[model samples]
Target: MNKSTTIWGHLSAAPHRSLFLAGSFQALLTILWWSIELAGRAGLVAPPLLSGITPTWVHGFLMVYTFFPFFILGFLFTTFPNWMNGEKIRPNRYMAVCLLMVCGVILFYAGLFAGKLLISAGLLLMLTGWANAIAALFHVLLTAPAGDKRHAWVAGTAFVAGWLGLCAYALWVLTDNTDMLNFSRQAGIWFFMLPILLTVSHRMIPFFSSRVLENYVVIRPFGLLWLMVGCAVAHGILHLLDLQGYAWWADLLLAGCALYLSYVWQFFRSFHVRLLAVLHISFAWLGIAMLSFGLQGMLFWLNGGEHYWLGLAPLHMLVVGYFASMVLGMASRVTLGHGGFPLKLDHLTWLLFIAFQVVIVLRVIPDILPFAASMAPKFYLAAGGVWLSCFLLWVIKYAPIYWRARVDGKAG
Candidate 1:
């Protein structure tokens, strides 16, 4: 281990701590959003904090644009330096950009709640933040050195597209227009889900699994690029045509891909510990969510046999299971790496991982069972509580490391 004085000095100098603090603040916001929703359902509040906005839209926006971006920022900041051949990106500029983004999200949400001109102001802030982030990402791609720049390029492109789509979405929401909203949502989904997740899984999943099982072969799907492009086109067309039933087919294809990937993953490796296990577990949910979407589509084709709630199941699964799990896992990994700690996670970390999984079960499983809908709010509350607790645990366990910096004199 490095000397304590050296570590402390490095930690004080590093920007990783600042980024982590921003991320933690975003996590707290997420928990607060969920808690407020729960309170509304429980009749503790007269009017729901999120009354006017559609719950699906609200949740999607928060998960995709709000909470996820902070992690993305942290990841980019921490990883880009190494990718850039050990040159550190300017920290002060990055911090300023982050502050703008965080403040933008706050204003956007406040406007969403207030239903006033603040929405436009929030959108402006968001656009400014996005421009800064994109510029930073571009700088990394052009200047930073990486063995596999393809993944970074893909992620960057997707992020840009997602941000643009979000701008369109804001306009639509502000104007009470559905056409723009539909277009923006589809574009955003393609950018947020397809390229980003695909790149992430490609980069991390196989490597993570290989740690548990020796000599594991990661199977890459043939023509995956073509398939992804096709899906994006199909999704856009379906939205344009207002062909609701076609979503099932789209989902089915996606699910099939995920299932094939999962099989390949499992064949290659099995992890005994929660840290590694969580990655696979989260990917499993991605597959399951797709399957649920397909199932919902099939039921819709049966002519009014399916309940509206059927669709909500897959949405929740994607949001709570796949996205949340991945974020938590990535955040945990980053926290350890940036802090100059060993990669091995402790029991508390494992418990937190398990709690995240439990939140998925509690949130999604009940939607399928009608009788369970009555109990859904209770489960949601419980799950949200667990999620909040986990974040709190994260803050308690990791804050010092984030604040103090790496133990080694090396930069994150």
Candidate 2:
């Protein structure tokens, strides 16, 4: 027993291991849910078995809440201590939370198919687990001995906002109110996901750029970070109120600032290194998402709120283009670096990175198809397939590294 435990101690004794376990598990689930969505949209099956929820709602919930959080927590739990120069986190703390999340997602699925009671139970468990993870990170932030800690605080605050969003979603689920659910979803995007990602991007991208580029200097002022947060919050409120007409102004200003900051931070110069290039290009997607948001809002206002472009394209641009690409880029860097592999990008990994953009473009096709109404289903199916394929490839490439002991003979 001792021998077996010792052999696998690396996996069980590390916070990043716990997070990677959760992340890889949910990556599979992410594809599974999306595949089901593809089938439903293609009219090849009956409606989803989950009562009181539409298929699109399920997709959004799992995509935004389920798998993505695992990525964020994985990144933060591993990186936060480094950011603050704090002590390493105990593995058991994160392991328990990871288990709760995994079980909650499983129960949510089981309830969707078998018993509705499990659905509520599953959501509750998931929220509890998420809250615990946030608390753990916040504890680290509060106790850190000596670092800037400002970025960590910003991330911690966004996490709290996410917690509140989850609470609201749970309330809406219990009440069965469509409006509240919609509000919660929008909040999940603008409040939780976007803010957290942008905060991390603001902190890490410039730092990474300066590290790799010889002449690069850190030029993104902290004030711009606050501005982005303020804009993100306002964007969420406007979305919640369905006041999208005015939201474009907020988005445009935010987009302009983000682009300007990227230039000042020398993001363009970071493209010289392949690994840094991945981070730089993925970060650019944020500006693109902001641009999409502004364009969508302007089009809606011009069309007298008739939604000429419908809001789907811009949302997908953010979710798939910005969020997923960043996750892939960061995950690759962290996973390889921690596993004691070289950070250099190989052909296969580069292909995987490019495929992510293809997935984003494919997903947006349905919204932009010119008078090809009958082809929308095919486009949707293709997009989901491409997405699933990306993860499938990712799992094959990285799962072994995650499960085995680290290459360096060092404790995590």
Model 2 per-residue lDDT at 193: 90
Task: List lDDT for all candidates, in order.
Answer: 0.71, 0.80
Compute the lDDT for candidate 1.
0.71
Best by lDDT: 2
Query: Model 2, 42-130: lDDT tens per residue?
Result: 67876466666666777788888887888898889888998998766677778878888888888888877776678888888988998
- Shift of residue 131 alpha carbon in model 2, Å: 1.6
TM-score of each: 0.86, 0.94
Off by over 4 Å in 2: 1-8, 45-48
Residue-level lDDT tens digits of model 1 in 1-412: 5677654454445455555666776777777786777678689776455426675576667667767777776676566555545446576666766678768777767876786467667767777877787787778778765465766777778788878778877887778788877767777666565567666776777877776666677665537644754665575567667786676787788788887878888832455655677778787887898788778877886666445547477877876788777777877887787677887778988888877778777777577787887787787788788788888887788777765646765665
RMSD of each: 4.0, 1.9
> What shift in Å separates residue 333 of candidate 1 from its native position after superposition?
0.7
